[model samples]
Target: MDKKKRVIFLVDMESFYASVEIASNPELVGKPVVVCGDPEKRHGITLAANPLAKKAGVKTAMPLWEVKSVCPQAQFVRPHMGKYIEASLQITEILYEFTDQVEPFSIDEQFMDVTASQSLFGSPQHMAKMIQKRIWDEVGVRARVGIGENKIQAKMACDRFAKKNLEGIFELNSTNYMKKTASLAVDELFGVGSRMKRNLYKIGIYTIGDLAKRPLEEMKKRWGVNGHILWLSAHGIDYSPVKNDSTELQKGVGNSITLPRDYIYKEDIQVVLLELADEVCRRVRALHKRGRTISLSFRGADFNHPTGFHRQTTIPFATSDTIEVYQASLQLLEHFWDRQPVRSIGLSLDQLEDDREIQLDLFSHPIKKLQLGKTMDEIRERYGKTAIFRASSLLSSGLLFDRATKIGGHEA
Candidate 1:
């Protein structure tokens, strides 16, 4: 309608990890490639690779042994977070030349809303081509661009075209979405992935057309929160505001650490748990909020088993005092920990709101006074984070102490 007023664009880098690897060594361009963790690591898996490796049936998240079998000639590269961050920042700067409404969805993908600036740059097709060229020239990376009326449509169109190896740009609306996407697997939808498609298949909706034609009420009956999202996406409706602001402000606060090694010692776990509780409270207070619930998560070295334990005891009073909060979390851990050797540990305090409520107490602990908290916070802020760490957190100087942490990853 009237030249598609809500013009949204999705730019996705192809084979991100592999592309960065080859960018450094052009000699590796045409080789089957895999970026994986240490092959000998107990559960390490491939993270990403080039089209050549994908064609040979090598895939990300596959065990290293399986990946090697798939593409024996494949070259493996370790992850370089520093390089990826620099490239992502550079690509974002290039996109800002066209509009400030750019949102980085991940390290390799972004959403841009140019609805207001289309006339300034010409039609959507011309805008996409110019943006793609700018990215290639400035970031030394190739990207596929998709134009639609909103974020969901643009992202799905990008995935659709990228899989077909077509030109870098794809434009779609309600009319062409189904026909253009008919041959593509529902699992290939930008947000569907494989697990989501499996769940949706149980409801007899196997394609974009199937989802688009289904009634909203029927969709909600089974999928709950996710159902509404899929239905709205089928109709190409995404009203989320593009993010253009800083991501520095803390919303929910938490802290965690890995043990030097697997530990079944009750005293050792209790020490790390107390230290993590203190760290979590510090972060929560720094944000000027009181928390009502504590979430505890931990893992063992054999990570096929991960345990998440959450405790929602109403804070006797909403307070950021570490001792009080840590006591509550200790009770939760005792209830959940089965005495297994744990490799990782974490604690979270949420259900946060403004810390406006004041607790009335005739005899409060003197150390829990407001002055002491403020004094400690200032000293840490000014001197350094390490200026004051709990004795329990004292471990090896190097990051080797956190080796057990990768077991749980960020599910903590």
Candidate 2:
């Protein structure tokens, strides 16, 4: 017997943060609402905007000042990431009622594989309507769903079609996806960003059809594995599965902060770097992972040009020691920083491995440092993050205390 076609649905929340705010308050039901970061702290970028705000030309990541200029009557609300997370979990639980193959793509998006569940739930479109209705009834949030034969098709179907449709549902399969999307711009295909579009344009590919017609080997020769993946996505061919378990290994661990103001002095920058290093290493230790590469990144205070540098170095040994990571980051900053005023700083640890075995060094006390880190982690876990911190965090430039109160760099 021939294999049965897969049925995948990508459910995306509409203006998630702003919608949550409106749902909880109720007073702002018909008003144009924008959810943003704290303007007083210079984190005033728009995180989400409701439909009315969007109609007034407000967009995600737009500056709050710009949003006000565009929609003067718009009501602003600070993001409640905790509340959003709760809603996301509730939606995930609702999805489980329909299928066990649900995978969360982001806090605002989830993918459901209903190949086997279609018999139980009826057609894919009917299942999508039921899921959308359940989410709206239970969570008071609006959702759009895209159905396809695979993940890539579902993602594009939702992002490019469903969200724009009044019915809030779309289906793109092997037979119809090309007919609908072929003449569209190359960048309209899933995963094709601006740079890739420019590259494709240089090679006489301007539409999805152009890319699909090109020989796969030529694309592979031009861009290697990424080229092949792009060709596959252009043809709506994705073999990836929707797995629920999170057995995937983390690629990196990092933290970044936008300073309340431009920091010019080396001492001030170092203070922030140390705080970031500590946070990153602490997370790595919690994962029981060690990394050999440390990366330092910064952005200049000039918003117009947005200039700075990102540099990384690999050491012989993998260790999650805060001081060691700090030292490496400090070196990178000293060597690369152009003495420019920095608006933001970031640090990350990658090239990871399980911390099952410790590498011995005659000059360094690795075991002792590891034990000390574990103890500090335990103390923080028991008493709270602010219970113990480096003395440097007491300095005026340090953001440890401020950061501890925030989740994903915003108020909790």
lDDT of 2 at 281: 88
TM-score of each candidate structure, all chains considered together: 0.73, 0.91
Q: What is the lDDT of residue 79 in candidate 2?
A: 82
lDDT of 2: 0.91
Show model 2 residue runs off by greater than 4 Å. Answer: 247-250, 285-293, 313-319, 351-374
Tens digit of lDDT per residue, candidate 2, span 201-255? Answer: 9999999999999999999999999999999998999999998853244667888
lDDT for 138 (candidate 1) = 69
Model 1 residue 146 CA deviation in Å: 2.1
Worst 10 residues of 2 by lDDT: 243-252
TM-score, candidate number 2: 0.91
TM-score, model 1 to reference? 0.73
